[model samples]
Target: MPKSAVVLLNRPSLEAPPHVEGAAEFELLDVDAPHVRVLDLGVTRGDGVFETISFGAGHPQALAAHLARLAKSARALDLPEPDADAWERAVLAAASAIDPAPEAYVKTVMTRGLEGDGRPTGWAYASAAPDHSRARSEGIRVVLLDRGYRHDVAKTSPWLLAGSKTLSYAVNRAVLREAARRDADDVVFVSSDGYLLEGSTSNLLLRFGDTLVTPGLDQGILAGTTQGDLFAFARSQGLETEYARLETRKLAEADAAWLVSSVRHAAPIRRVDGVDRAVDTDFTAAVNSHLIGRTS
Candidate 1:
């Protein structure tokens, strides 16, 4: 289960796996090929959605919680509900296919099938993404944007382009490009309401003094999987925590901040525009101990 630093998606070398109908039942067509299965949640009228989870190597909780959150996220999206039993079966099947001695990142993506003639073609798919562990420590740089992606989806966005990870990732890509233009590594969006939403691909966090703060989900932010665990770990260790509408000024003043997600884990925020600061603190050690069961 050795994961690649960067997965060659366009260059899928692993063989396609047989149909993955349930969670525990998956089969790779070949060792050198990557099998990406498809499941359709028949929604043609722009109501499509999916979730991604991170089950870190050897640590079962990450994956377990990810699955639990996946079910909840599916419910939140209000699309067709996924069969839990089938999901469980799929997980087992996928894991069985892997060599357990080495574990890689496991991701499950569910999407809404094509909708046409003013409706959707009923279909949904999920895939176990190949593990890419390199992004965790090297860190990701992000650009801050004045505009945010709080759109109404199914919800025609660029017709034939749904933003539910269903299809249209153009905007997401564009945002990244914009970030690149600004000399930043990634992007973090600020709402007109003045609350910090999130990065283009993940959640935002700030460690203020001894307290950790983030924007609440009420602000149209995606509930981050790693963020939840980080906060939980922080609380367990006697650190104060809070979730509320965040302002750009507060983030600029934060002692330390990070953009978190499954793939990147936590990328420290080095500097915010108009606010020059140094990112010399290492919360990674503390966070790693709390997250991965490593003791100092």
Candidate 2:
């Protein structure tokens, strides 16, 4: 079996017409070949939405939540509602086609097709996850950067696509380079008004004694499915959880902090802006253990 797989959906959205008449739901394709068109809006304008779902032992984690968020992001972009059933099947097929591993991810994308084509392009790509053992155990250093948006941007400027998980990730990628230049491994974005937001591709999680707090969803950040699952895990372990509008100082003052996402699971923050912070190795280990052992 190949290390990666790809499944192209014939009809990404039931609300839109199929790519071909009477075609099967999806078709497995060569992972390395060129599949997207040069003029595709997703390529030209970064107009699309996507979800990366991590699977453990062939079981995709947070499948329902990821699909739900995909649809929500589609709605946010005024794109056709993604056919959840079709996507689920595609995700599973792509995942199973690849070589089994302890960790892997399937990225589902729906892009607005050629400018006037109307038909959207959708595909699910699966591959074995990278080794994140170092980050998970040793932790990572992060720097804080200004996001140039207010905490209320989602409400005040919905047109800016604040809370939506769109394909335009130039800024997200740029931040990582900035982090590297600053001698850090990652970053946590702060709103223009000094409110904490989220990471480039992960969610900010701060532990305050026995409580775990994440920035509220209203702050124009993607609702992290992994973070949600972690919250449930925390509750099961008798840890309190909360969603609040956190200020920058709160992160510096937290007992411990991590950047959690589907693929990386949880990476504890060891340093912020050149200041070394204490890492809770015991709790971090427990969190990662639960995440990797998840069957659903």
Q: Highest lDDT, which number? A: 2
- Candidate 1: tens digits of C-alpha lDDT, residues 1-296: 42222111211101222232242233333434533333333222324444444334434335555656655654555434555454554444444445552333444444443332222221112233444343344445665686533333223333433222333345667888888787777788887545577888778888888899998765556667688889988888898989877777777778878888765566777656534554534676467445544211
RMSD of 2: 0.7
Clash list (residue pairs), candidate 2: none
> So what's the TM-score on candidate 2?
0.99
Give the runs in model 2 whose Cα sits over 4 Å from its true position: none
Each candidate structure's TM-score, on Cα atoms with residue i matched to residue i, is 0.69, 0.99
Error (Å) of candidate 2 at residue 28 is 0.4
lDDT of each: 0.54, 0.96
After the best TM-score superposition of candidate 1, give how far the Cα of residue 294 lies from its true spot, in angstroms. Answer: 8.9
Worst 10 residues of 2 by lDDT: 112-121
